[model samples]
Target: MEVAELKAIIEGLLFASGDEGITVKQLQKVLGISKETVDHLLEELKYEYERRDRGIMIMSSNEVLHLTTKPEHSDYYKKLLEVPQSSRMSQAALETLAIIAYRQPITKTEIEDIRGVKSDRPIQTLVTRSLIEEVGRKESVGKPILFGTSKEFLTYFGLTSLDELPPLPDTDEPEDINQEADLFFERFNDELE
Candidate 1:
């Protein structure tokens, strides 16, 4: 109801939106507020973050708003990513990476469809770690970004080329999704060790 409460709610919405981000229209609808109020709240929030010297700031891209780390802090972020402990990938990240490594230039939606779960965080982690990158945009609706393995991927996996990847097992037999994921994990883990 109050301006402060409105701003706080908007902040939470932005955070929960993750990499996909929230649009002004969506925010307005969610909060039952007008576009002008949403815009004012966003600008005020941005100014407060800047004035408060916060690590994250509000960013707008293609009409979507997200809470993103300040670009000036990129050096620290890069170092954080380089830490040995951070090198270990989660099962989801490994699954997403395997799909991208094999498929090459695949969309996030496609990856999610295969994994049967949202791949945003895994994709973000892979991109931040430089193991995957935006190879190009698909020609379909929205021209969604197509992700592919980066050169760093090969280096990290100790491979000179993608040709070094092991062949996939035959899919002629209908298998459970978990079985497929385990197969991928086992193959990659063997390669890693």
Candidate 2:
């Protein structure tokens, strides 16, 4: 492949990697190129971004490369972070929030079990909304991340503490469990509105 095509591929890989960033070894293996070639391409891409005055730029740390907004654009990013929450939560996000709120320090697997579906998107939404966070890791194998409500959750719900949450009614039936969750979501949404 041409040098230009190699640089483009490296740029795409960096962008797609997001915050985790792509390691030098990973890039070399994927492109089937030598480490020196990957390093040279990355430096060229970095210089091009700087020379062109692009809004986004390539960043490297500890042999990992990722794309990030230029430092000069910090003001714009701050404005975005300060934007008010004008949108309502989706049903899946509401359900995921309900599960996390009630079951403190729960793992994704436990949340999925309760919701009866993959909860990755909903969990990500909750984290983005600042309603939930990774409190710690479970002690079992793999030590999966344990999520719990953030202080933002209390502020959003107008509760001073988790203890202020309404008591759940007792029910033994499997169907009642889902109904109870829906009820909690409805009540929470009603209060917010």
Candidate 3:
């Protein structure tokens, strides 16, 4: 493929990779090209982005490449973040968020076990809202998707880290799950206010 076409493809890949950036080896394998060619293309892409007035730029760290907004646009991003919460979360979503925050790296089945009800809709809503994301998959049969709070979740809650979350009380009964969720939500709302 031509250099322009190759660069376009690489841009698409970087954008799709999200926070988990793509590595040089992965790009080389995907393009079926030599490491040198991939490196050259990436350097050229970086140069082009730097030369032009682009809102997005390619970033590399730890030998991984990803596309992200330019630093100059951070003010706009902050303003966007300051927008009021579009809508209040449903009770089910709050419950799912509480469960995921306390017992993260959890799977759908585990969440269901704790709630004693189908959690698909709540999980979907959390994911859609970027509060929760698939951190990984379980190694057991079926390799179910493991869920966890995201950086956006921390930002939304005004927390510097997950360590700031209130310590969960010891409990084993499923019935107590709702109470725990309520308490967690109360703390979160207090922080928001």
Candidate that would win on lDDT: 3
The superposed Cα distance between candidate 3 and the true structure at residue 109, in angstroms, equals 0.8
The number of clashing residue pairs in each candidate reads 0, 0, 0
Instruction: Give per-model TM-scores.
Output: 0.57, 0.57, 0.52
lDDT per residue for candidate 1 within 1-68, as digits (tens), equals 99999999999999988988999999999999999999999999999889546899999899889899
Q: Model 3, range 34-128, lDDT digits (tens) per residue?
A: 99999999989888888557788888899888898889889999999788665567788888889899889999999989887678778988998
lDDT of 2: 0.84
Rank order by lDDT, top first? Answer: 3, 1, 2
**How far in Å is the alpha carbon of 139 misplaced in model 3?**
0.2
RMSD in order of candidates: 5.2, 6.5, 11.2
Q: What is candidate 2's lDDT per residue for 64-173, written digit by digit as tens?
A: 87798888889999999898875478788888888888888899999888888778778888999899999999999999999999999998878899998777669766
Q: Of the pair 1 and 3, which is ahead by lDDT?
A: 3
lDDT for each candidate structure: 0.85, 0.84, 0.86
The model with the greater TM-score, 2 or 3, is 2
What is candidate 2's TM-score against the reference?
Answer: 0.57
State in Å the error of residue 13, model 3. Answer: 41
